[model samples]
Target: MTHVITYDIGTTGLKTCVFEITNQIQLIGSTTEGYDLKILENGGAEQDPNDWWNAMCLTTRRVLQENHLSPEDIQGISFCAQMQGLVLVDKHGEPIRKAMSYIDYRAKKEQKEGIGNGFKIGGANIVKLSKSLYITGAVSASVKDPVWKYKWVQQNEPENFHKVHKWLDVKEFLISKCTNKFVMTEDSAFATLLYDVRKGKKRFSREICQMFGVKMEHLPEIIRCTDMAGKLTEGAANELSLKEGVPVFGGGGDASLIGVGAGAVGPGSTHIYFGTSGWVSTVVKKRVLDINHMIASIIGANSGHFNYFAELETAGKCLEWVKDHLAMDESNLYLEKNQISEEKAVVYKNLYDYMMDAIAHVPAGSNGVIFTPWLHGNRCPFEDPNARGMFFNIGINSGKSDLIHAVLEGICYHFRWQLEAQEKKVNTSPVIRFVGGGALAPITCQILSNVLNRNIEVVEEPHNVGAVGAAVVTAVGLGLLSKIDDANQLIQVRDRYTPDPETKRTYDKYFPVFQSLYKNNKKAFEVLNSQ
Candidate 1:
């Protein structure tokens, strides 16, 4: 068996995992380290690169020590990280400024000037949008897309922008730190919306760069996800207590790899991920863009494959908010570091478990209440930064449990909407794999299955699926695996959920109402949130 290390760089923290690759992939040890996401008052979300590095070093050491393994035991390393982040670096691979997160929407001014003005369709300039669609099969119309972030920095922070030698996404920055080689994976490159996706042209589009006022030279060399970037350098090696010559592969973004990890690498394979953010993605043979719905096909880790992705900005985050506010007393039972009494601890292992139990007693349809899961704005089927979450149709009879259940149902309802939009363009897998931290709850699995009226399969270690995808990349790079599709043989599904006829009927009734909530409130949202 060959051993490899993979990093899942999430929004709130970094997770490092050690995997044994043989006939199957086995997670040996895992560790996580948290960091701060600096939320600026002006809708800016940034993170210090140093914090990511520190978290990486800490987690690497802890996972290695806990597994009783040494540096020599690790054969390869790769990453699966959040995509569309703006990480500008200097010539020496140092960050020019705090990395702008995918959640950052401070680029509104830049977005308006770039694509939102003039004759428009779907809130974007018609001529520019048409060109973008024809060239890249996607458009950077969202205020949070990386192109706008790049322009935001160029116009607002000229000094830092001038110092930048290369532009990178989150994983590419870490790869540069490890290998001292400036490179980006194909998937990361495509997220920029500046990459040409034509059959014979798979490079950065000079035309698009010029159109957006971005320097073409700032883009780095793009490599396939399975290719080795370079060997780890002495500095990165010493910092992580690993060997200097360990091969580092070109890992991909979560959208690309999480599906690969879940055995959804083949065309038409579908997966739904509910994490801090959520997405409905399906592997497809050709690139596709639904400008009307804000869904697009993005480059995948596997060659010639693309993931038709539709995302919701806040998924489990809505649950986080509900736990903290609507269920404050219950959240204190397990979420806080404070010691829980033995009696209470025996009843519930964590806040999620407590919530699942509480909501299990609440009937489907959230007792006639519908909640929108757009706490931090929304994307997909509708691109409205002004949208906010609300508990609709709440009567005096509605209680805290009903509202909490509505939050979970709301997230599921949104995923179903994204899936329906995708079905309009391409065929998605009948039985979808459900992976992410949210899948740990059985109630969530059932609710999702019922809401979508499809089979939901949960694999072992659902939360680590992204790391598993990264491991598959490293294994392919090391020649332990012949291709990415072999990952299907390695991952084992832990549970299967099918829609309950009675529950499906209840959810079916509320799903239409949930869909109407956004359309009905669009004007109200814009009016109330106009800044």
Candidate 2:
């Protein structure tokens, strides 16, 4: 039986899996490896490209060895990576500097000028710097379009920019390492702020490149997501324990692949992902740009398709921070009282369970308390980088559980805001499919369902959806599947959560207050940051 090997290179780690083509299900053989993102002061995020390659090699080797399969058993390999990271490479494909990740805020200075001063491009002024430059054309032309983090590198690190040969996205860098092919997918290319979304074509926008002082030849050739980029070279194959000549399909950004993997294809199908960041996206037959341009519309996985994605800059990360900081005192108390190692493990689980139970007991809307989930910044509806999270209506009676519930509700309120904006643009209200680490939390999923007043379908195998999506793309590239719909039929839905009517009604009342908090506090946040 033929199998497809897939890699999902996410922000936190690499996940490698082998899927059987006939059943369209993942086999038992899989491996995982962790990777770290270097966070610098002033919200700068960087990573060595070699770390991804090394993790890919180590995990691939382990998967092969654990499965006891020969390299010849694998048919094809493809990858899905985090979107919008900027990597500079030399002519020989060697990385010139650490990759500037999507999370990095060092470009805030450039972004501020573009959005704050109302820089106009294509005959319109963009209000939010990050959104305007990324979605609109208020960027420099010299460096393959200044909408990318590359512009920040050019202005801030001139010496490093001078040595740069080619600019590649994270997935493109991996493809170059595996097959020596420098190619990019449309999904990744559209995020660069250079691609003309209306035209559905990609090239180094000479207009923007000139502004940034970069040449067009510095960019990679853009291709469709399903295109056969190249074959695995002997060296990469040997290192990963895979066969040479195995076709490497042009994969896509994690969001696009997750949409495909969750079967969120065709019109009206939507998926909401909650990881470090939160996103709500829906597939459309054609591009539908918002009138206000509040949400980002980008190229979808399939050719001639498009997706509208609304993001909340922080989701799970907010919860993680609360757990780490607020729960530390409780954690230490439990640890000191617990005697054995096994008891200590139980204590940790009990603490988390207690927190969830407390959150579950709290009524919908957290008794009028609201959170913004803008710990990182606002991504959609507001698009304000200066946006700060707030816990409004907190009282002396409010405890840790109320605070936790409020945070979760705040994130849900943001989703509702995006959904309302989306409904105005699209005629339909579709059921939402949940995928990613956040879906694992039952309380959070239930809260989302209550707030959105829609059924939420959580995939049983949420963690591997992106990897599975990549394998499905590989299958299509290799002629195993004729259309994406065929692959969709093979996908299984494991669980479904329905919203409670009472909870939904409660959330309906509180969502407006949630909206007002941001409006009233926006200027305050900006002023506070300025100081």
Candidate 3:
């Protein structure tokens, strides 16, 4: 057996996991450290790179000590991180400014002037859109995309932009700190929508870069996800209480590897992830694009494959917002009560559990209430930064339980929307793997099953799927496994949920209204939020 450490870097926190990889992937120890994501005025989201490094150091020491293992025992290290973040680093690999979070949309003006204005189709300049699609199978159409972030910095923070030595994603920045090597895995490179996806041309496209006014020099060397980036350096080793020269694999973004952790690497294999953000992805043999719906196939960690992907900017984040605002009383219970036992004496661990327990008996459809889960805006099926979440059709009879249940159902409704959009182009697996922090709740699993009317499979340690996927990449890099496809044999499902026809009927009744909510309120959203 080989021991490895995988860091799953998320928007709000970092999760570190130690795994024993053999024929099966066993999680031995783990830790999570959170950092703040500063939400600036005008849709700017940022995080300090130093905060991430500190969290890594703190979690690394704790997990290693708790597991009674030394750094030398860890055969390799890897990362699966949030994608599309823009981290501009200087010659010394230090960040020139605060890293732009994936949700940052301050590039509205840049997007407008760059691509949103002029002769356009689907809100993008037709000429540029066609070129981008021809080369990359995607377009930098959203204000939140990395190229626009780079442009935002160039026009607004010209001094910082001049000092940038290379552009890196969240995982690439961490990889640089660990190994003193500046590189981006294929998956991260492709997310920029600047890389050429044509056969025998897996490199960054000079034409797309020039069209977008991006300096190719700022981009880092591209490497496959299964390649070794470099060895952990002495400075990083000392900070994390580890040995130097430990191989650091070129890990991928959550989009590419989370599905791998769910054993959804094969073509047509689908998985749904609900975390701070959520997405529906299916492995496909070739690239696919649906410009109308804003869904496209992105390069995955596996060679010659793409992930047909759709995203929801905020998924479990809506739950977080509910816990903060709507569930104030329940939040107090969370602090006052550490654990609660029921007839089964099941110890409730987190506030979500208590919240789920409180709403477990609430019927499907939230009793005629519908909710839109666009708290931070949306991506797939539509691209509207002005869109905001709301609880619709709430009557005087509606209770807190109804609203809370509606939030969960609202997210599931969006998932179904994305799933159907994907199905329009390609077939998806019937037994979809559900993995993420949200999947820990059985109620959520069942609600998702009912809403989508498909079997929902949950693996052990659903929250750590990203970390496990990173470990699988490391194992392949270290030659412990023959290929990534071996993950299907290692990660097994712990539970499978079948849809309840009666519950499905209730959800089916409301799903149409949920779909119409966006179209009905879009004008109102733009009018109110166009600031």
What are the clashing pairs of model 3? none
Per-residue C-alpha lDDT of model 1 across residues 112-140, encoded as one tens digit per residue:
99999999998899998988898988999
Please give the RMSD of candidate 1 to the true structure: 2.1
**What clash count goes with each model?**
0, 12, 0
My TM-score estimates for the predictions, one after another, are 0.96, 0.89, 0.97
Candidate 2 vs 3: which has more lDDT: 3
Candidate 2 on 436-465: residue-level lDDT in tens? 877877888899998998999887577678
lDDT tens per residue, model 3, 169-286: 9999999999889999999999999999898999999999999899999999999999999999999999988889999999999999999898889998999999999999999998
- Position 454, candidate 3: lDDT: 99
Error of 2 at 516 (Å): 2.1
Once superposed on the true structure, which residue ranges of model 3 sit more than 4 Å away at CA? 330-346
The residue ranges of model 1 lying beyond 4 angstroms of the native Cα positions read 330-340
By summed lDDT, the worst window of 10 consecutive residues in model 2 runs over 137-146
